[model samples]
Target: MGLKPWQKALFPLRSVAAVVRLFEAELRQPEPDLVLLSLVLGFVEHFLAVNRVLPTNVPGLTFESRPGPDPQTRLYFPVAELSIVAALYARFTAQIRGAVDLSLYPRPDGCSSRELVRKVSDVIWNSLSRSYFKDRAHIQSLFSFITGEEGPPRVPPGTKLDSSGVAFAVVGACQVLGLPDVHLALSEDHAWVAFGAGGSQTAEVTWHGKGNEDRRGQPVQAGVAERSWLYLKGSYLRCTRHMEVAFMVCAINPSIDGHTDSLELLQLQQRLLWLLYDMGHLDRYPMALGNLADLEELEPTPGRPDPLTLYHQGIHSARTYYNNEHIYPYLYLAGFHCRNKNVKEALEAWADTATVIQE
Candidate 1:
C-alpha cells in the first residue's frame, strides 16, 4: 500500500532525520496547533476505514513485531502543515470572540473570576445543540473550540465534542480572550477548569458521567467531600498548557481492533510523551506518566526510566500535586504488577491505594 492522497497532503515524514528535526522544533513550539498532534491522530484515524490494517494477534500489551520496519516504513509522524493549523487557530479565536459579548463577563478579580469562567463555559456548553448526546466516542484536539470528530466527512450537526473537549474549548477560548489564569482541571474520569489566583476557584466546563445534572460552570466543592473515585477523593490536576499537551498526547487512540493498533500512531504517541516528559511537562500529570509507563512496559525505551519507576513517579505526582488523595496512580501500578504476575507487588500497590482511600 502506498501513501493515500490526504496523507501525502500532510507531508508525512519517511526518515529518522525528519523525526529529530520535528522533535527539536516541537520543544520550542508555542501554539497547540503547530504540533498538530490531534490532527495527526485524526489523520491516521481518518484513513483507518480504508486502511485494511488488520489487528495484530499478539497476546498482551507488548507486540512481537512492531508495525513498520527499517527506513522504508509506512509509519511516519506528520507535523501538521502551518496553513491548516493557522486556519483552525484563527477560526476558533474568532468564534470565541464573536460568540459572546466578552466585555459583559469581565474578570472582576483581575484574574479569571468565577463569572467570566462561567460565561466561557456557557458559550461552549450552549453550543451543544445536542446536549443530551455529548458522550459519543471520538478523539479530542486543540483549537479554541475543543471537539471530537470521527470519519472522513464534515462533523454532522448535533454531534457534540467529548467532555474534556468541552473543557479544553472553554480554557482555550479563555486563552484567546487573554486569560492565562484559566487552566484545565482533571480528575481521572472527568475534566473541567480551575481558575482564579493560584487556581483557587474551580468550575465544571463539561458534563460528567451519564445521567448526572449538568454542572457546567458550578464550583467543585461538595464533590471533594463526597469522597469517591468519581472525584478521585479531591485528587485533581490543575494543568499548565504543557501538561495539557501531555494529556492530549496521552489521550491519543491508536487501536485498530480487538488486538490491533495503529503502529504509527502508537509510536507517535510514545515519542511525543517522551519529548514532553524530558521537558518536565508530565511532572504534575500522573495519568500521563502512567500512560507512558504502560507503553514502556510493552516497548521499553532505552535510556529512559523503566515501567515500574515511571508508575511510581505517577503516584508521586499525585502525591505532590493532589496531597496523595488521588488513587488512580496507585491503581495503575497495581494493574501493572497484576499483569506481570508480580502478585506480592500488586498486593502492596493495592494496599497503598486503599490507604489513600482511607485518608
Candidate 2:
C-alpha cells in the first residue's frame, strides 16, 4: 500500500492512510467483512487496556478501558487501529480451527448444529483460569478470548468468559471455518448460534443462568415450547452479519467511570448504529431500533427521525415481525413516553405492554 506524498497529506498517519485506502476497495465488494475488522480492532483496544499497558487516569494522554459491571475492570476501544487486528484475527481463527477440525463436524446435525457449535464453545469456556471471576463486564468479548486478560494484570486470575461471549465465540469460529450460514441468535439474556438452511437450525452454545452447567448441545425450540420468558415465545433475533454488527454496537460501553462517558466511543457507536439503521439492517431487530433510539434521544442527529419515531418503529417491528411477542420494544417506547411527561400516551403504552405480556 503506497501512502500519499507527505507534502500532500494534511496529517501524515501512514497507517491510517493505508487502512483507509484498503477499506475504500474492500467496502465496495458485494459484501465487505468490516465486522471482522471491527471486532478485531475492539479486541486490540481491550487487550492494551486490561494488561495495564495503558494508564487509565488520563483521557487523552493514555487509553483506558470503559467501566463495565466491575468498576475494577475496563477495556479500551479505538476505531482506526489496525496494526494488531490482523495478527489477532489470524491467531484467534487458528485457535478455534485447531479446537475442532471441520472434517469432524462437516455439517449441521439433526440436533440443531450442536456438535459443531459445542466444539467452538468448549474452546472458549475451558480456556479461562480455574475459579476466575465471571461477572466482569468487558470480558464478554473476543478480547478476553484472545488475550486471557479479563481485567488488569493486578486484578488477579479467574476471568471466565460471560455466557454471551461463548456463544459469540462459537458463531465467530464458524465464520472462521467458512460457514457464513452460521450466525448469532440472541434473546433478552441468552445467546446461541443459528445455522443450516436459512439459519433455521439453532442450538444452545452458552449457559443461560448460574449454577447449572451449560446446555451446550440442545435445540432452542425447547425453551420456546416450555414457554420460558427467556425465549420470548419465538421472539428472538436470528441475526445476519449486519444485525450482529448492530448487536456489537448496542453492546458498546463508554463509561470511564459510573459518572463519565468517552464521547469519542459514544460518537463512534452512534455513527455505526446510524449506518446500520440506514442500511435497513435493523428492520427485524427491534431492540436495535430501541437502542439506536436511546442514542438519538441523547444526541439528536440533525437529519434523522426523532427518538419518538425510532421508538415507535421498534414497537411496530416487534408487532409485525415477532408477532408482538417481544416486550422490550413496547417497554422502551413506554419508558420514553413516561420520561417525556406524556402521561396519557405512556399509560396507553403501558396497557399495550400488558397485552403483550398476557400473550
* Top candidate (TM-score): 2
Query: CA lDDT of each candidate?
Result: 0.68, 0.67
lDDT of 1 by residue, 1-359 (tens): 22224433544333333443454455565544322444444433433422344435512211122245775654433334445444554555666788767678666667877878888888777766553455433435443133333434774544356778778767767877778888888888888888889899898877767775688778888887777666777777778777777776776667766677766666667888898888888888888989999999888888999999999999888888788977788999999999999999999999999998787
* Local accuracy of candidate 2 as per-residue lDDT tens digits, 251-337: 666555567665555665677677677768889999989988888888999989999999999989988888788888888888998
TM-score of 2: 0.79
Model 1 worst lDDT run, 10 consecutive residues: 58-67
Residue runs of model 1 more than 4 Å from their true location after superposition: 1-67, 70-79, 129-136, 142-159
The 10 consecutive residues of candidate 2 with the worst lDDT sum are 7-16
Question: Which candidate should be chosen as best, given lDDT against the real structure?
Answer: 1
Total clashing pairs in model 2: 5
TM-score of each: 0.79, 0.79
